[model samples]
Target chain A: MTAPSQSPIYDRVALIGLGLIASSMGHAMKKWGLARSVAGHARTAETRAAALELGFCDEVFETAAEAAKGADLVVLAVPVGNMGALAEEIAPVLKPGATVTDVGSVKQAVIEAVAPHIPNGVNFIPGHPLAGTEHSGPRSGFATLFANRWVLLIPGEAAPDAVAKLRAYWEAMGAFVEEMDAAHHDLVLAVTSHTPHLIAYTMVGVADHLRRVTESEVIKYSAAGFRDFTRIAASDPTMWRDVFLTNREATLDILGRFTEELFMLQRAIRMGDGDMLHDYFTRTRAIRRGIIEAGQDTAAPDFGRSVTGAGE
Target chain B: MTAPSQSPIYDRVALIGLGLIASSMGHAMKKWGLARSVAGHARTAETRAAALELGFCDEVFETAAEAAKGADLVVLAVPVGNMGALAEEIAPVLKPGATVTDVGSVKQAVIEAVAPHIPNGVNFIPGHPLAGTEHSGPRSGFATLFANRWVLLIPGEAAPDAVAKLRAYWEAMGAFVEEMDAAHHDLVLAVTSHTPHLIAYTMVGVADHLRRVTESEVIKYSAAGFRDFTRIAASDPTMWRDVFLTNREATLDILGRFTEELFMLQRAIRMGDGDMLHDYFTRTRAIRRGIIEAGQDTAAPDFGRSVTGAGE
Candidate 1:
């Protein structure tokens, strides 16, 4: 029988990490009553306490297995490098018919690491939410973080009903859900997220190591273009490190292409090839227009950044 | 003589090339009464008409010379490549004791191109405003574009009074003004603006050229990191081309360093060096905090991007 419209989708949901994505999920689930009870586990006592204090979770556990016990759905929200160990830890306690999904940026590695440990009756779906801010941690999340975002699900070997249920849950959290294969999801994310974050980190590192440009000058004059790169680079270090480490092949492939293209532009600059530079830049500009038209980004000047406190 | 608080800084100010910077300056001047009469010139008649219709300028001229004649201050706001030609066109019409400035990105090149064309009694101070958006054109200007933004003035060979007067004018327009030499300005900008922009353009171009990732997917899932690069890459193509061409030496130097560092990061990723990646990412994260502390950028998550219309 179908439940009432206002009824919770799951009797109880377990979140294995109390980072940005998991905390935001907890908030969204609580705001919409998507789950009757939300339980959480974090690596450190401090994070567990923070999650409980934040009130996104009804209860917190010291161990992920304890959190997974009696849960209708278990969400793996840890860094990619820790996914396999966490999955092994929580496997014994996973309830039969419970669906397990992850919120990792990389998909294939997550599938490989988490799938083998899942029980036969339980569903193991790897999912990624294409949404985040530079900030992280339990306190950095809000209910609206995934409101307009896309959540990609990889339902390998999962029952049709299980897949549908997971999709419905994400939809309830204000995200548009799509089905994607793990390998393809990893490649798409490499181009869209992993490679771009690497470039941003590299650029920021370059700025920091510059002896001629003082640290203050780099910070003060960052409004031009460097500030945007810094924002991307400012993302949680451990999480990003795991992303790069686990998604090595795809990230390196994209990075190689990036360097090839960058060298071409560098040559154009050295050769004073204005037409080449102009044409390349014009092509890139068109892509930006496409993004704006797709409503993936705001067309407001400077991402609608307020000018307040800039003068003070 | 000190003018009253409400009085204009200049009797008549001429703005050459009615684009983003010029139109923004016009709006700021009008809003703050920084100038008694604002005159503007654009290469295209449509832009000239738009400037007049936008009401940022009191009058619009078809020729730079006509706009410069009898003006107390003249601003060369054209692209870097056009600065020399524009300066020559307006040189004969510059009034005695008047100060001429530019809003070019590359200072040394602008000085080299425009300095020789300056009339003996007229002051030519090369300046650059560290403010802009992904958009350009006469209509893209706003009164607060320069608010709290830094405007670096290279007041080489200009009289102290002329430099002070121009500083006061910029202050009235809501900008914090600083002075730097032409070579140092070009180098600093290359590190802070030029190199970062080139990298962004290259990243966007790579995304555009990818065969595996569909354009729709790249645009739709851009919220992760690529969207920021698109914003920086969407900046005016012609202006950016001129910047790379004119600031070739410094841009090349910084580009070399950037690639070197990028290769290091790439190698680390290839070797699965998580600690190295984490440390580098953490270091860059600190720089972003510094920028927010310096009031150069907002601390808002994702630049406080609104989630409205994101789902619809």
Candidate 2:
């Protein structure tokens, strides 16, 4: 690690395929003065201008190669499907000995996509930051978004030194970083994140189709339970679509198990079994306590208000 | 309404059936001096003792008729299934010109069950209070539980004076009083509260059975959408069973519509139609916004904390 006086992690930090994660990284780096200069590149020119106009990145480039030139760290922050192409675009232009990493939710796809293009002199690391808002794109970027959030680092079993340095970089950016195998990461996330999203999507879909009742009534009475699903279902359609498409195997596996369990619960409800409902509801309480103790959430997320004074 | 300093609504109030709602009403009455004394009677002495020990009611009695002796107002707070039996027990002892009300979730059943055995000079006013916690028994009672919540009164046109009096009593207890037809109230509540609870119960039941991947993961990663269902499902199972049994026709009507709508979304997912998924997800966002505007929920509830808070 650098001395406190020389604390900079990167001289020119390049952010490739900017979206909610990438743009937020740029904002965070600038906020903490962790990088000398923050430059970003996206496939869409409109998005490039948005990155610049939003003032999230110091420099915006249309091509990944241009953005990567001379930068010491390049973060791939795109949909998993676009990671390979972005890797190919930046590989030849990245500085020798520079560290390349990513912030995709799924680490396996990210590692497989970006590792092949890493040249002899460069190090490629895969990371998945567990922090995010349902909103996407540059406008949703915030400096403190990743503070206290988990970022899983999967660099295989080969590059200890590079992985250590990337872990320090994430730490500097106000994130808690851990190292795990890409496959295990996928499975754990499938249980925690993907399955939850799928269930939410399904519930929202169910509520959306209920006929006889006017839409106004559903909208009015969502506080009963359906509102929570709406928030999760409102997540970026394109990003979630890519998630289900790319992580199909794990998601489907979990869903199949979930359906079977649901059928059992249905049978109990039909049979007028209150004890069964009581026991399951009671057991789930412990896990929610674990999540809170894990600091995965606050007393409540005060959205649209930026009310962090309670914690501060 | 009695100019703020008039006599209590009931000189001697007898609260039949001690449960969460009854206990809460007892607490609110005690806290603000809304009623002189909350004399309660439960079928079993155990619940009556529990209520007295919890300090939820001022006094406890073993028999409904003994509790109703000389009482100017009687509130039935039992399960809908037992309302008729309790009414029969209390009918002979109630004072002349007494005003009787209930806090059942379903309106029509409460009225039908209690209205029959009413004494010649008594007035029966059916009520439905839309406020409760998942926790049951007297200890769960809190004065503020009904604060800002809706309390619906169904006087069926003829009992306007009694309805108006009950509205004042609820308002004094910090509730917003709404007048709805008994049938219309049941239908709206089935869509708003009943159907949502059933669906949540069903989904959590599903999650519990899917233990291979979803059992633990469902609770841990509940934020994706499933957590909402789990929280709703975690509500008191006995109360819900009573709700379903009492509001059968409306609950079934909404359930049939809900299943049909759910099938449509299932077909879209099976066909991999991104546009349909996006459209439904997007439309649901507006409904959530509307719910928020209706002052139903704070910006966002504590996702993981909600499941735990249900107990608190």
Clash totals, every prediction: 0, 4
Q: What local lDDT score does residue B23 receive in model 1, on the 0 to 100 scale?
A: 94
Residue B141 of model 2: what lDDT? 75
- Model 1 lDDT, residue A17, Cα: 93
Q: Which residue pairs clash within candidate 2? A: A261-B206, A261-B209, A261-B210, A262-B206
lDDT string for model 2 (A1-312, tens) is 111224667788899877878888877777777788888888888899998888778898878899999988888888777888888877888788888888776777777778888898788778787767766777877887766555778877546777787787778776667677887777667666766665566555555555655665555444445555566666666666656656666666666666555555555556656577456655554443443454345522221122111010
Model 1 spans with C-alpha error above 4 angstroms: A1-5, A296-312, B1-5, B296-312
Tell me the DockQ of each model, to 2 decimals: 0.54, 0.29
How would you class the docking of model 1? Answer: medium
For model 1 chain A, the run of ten residues with the poorest summed lDDT:
A303-312
Q: What is the lDDT of residue B228 in candidate 1?
A: 71
lDDT of 1 at A292: 77
TM-scores of the models, in the given order?
0.93, 0.82
lDDT at position A82, candidate 1: 94
TM-score (chain A only) of candidate 1: 0.92
Candidate 2 backbone overlaps, count: 4
Q: How high is the lDDT of residue B114 in model 1?
A: 88
RMSD of each: 4.8, 5.2
User: Model 2, residue B103: what's the lDDT?
Assistant: 82
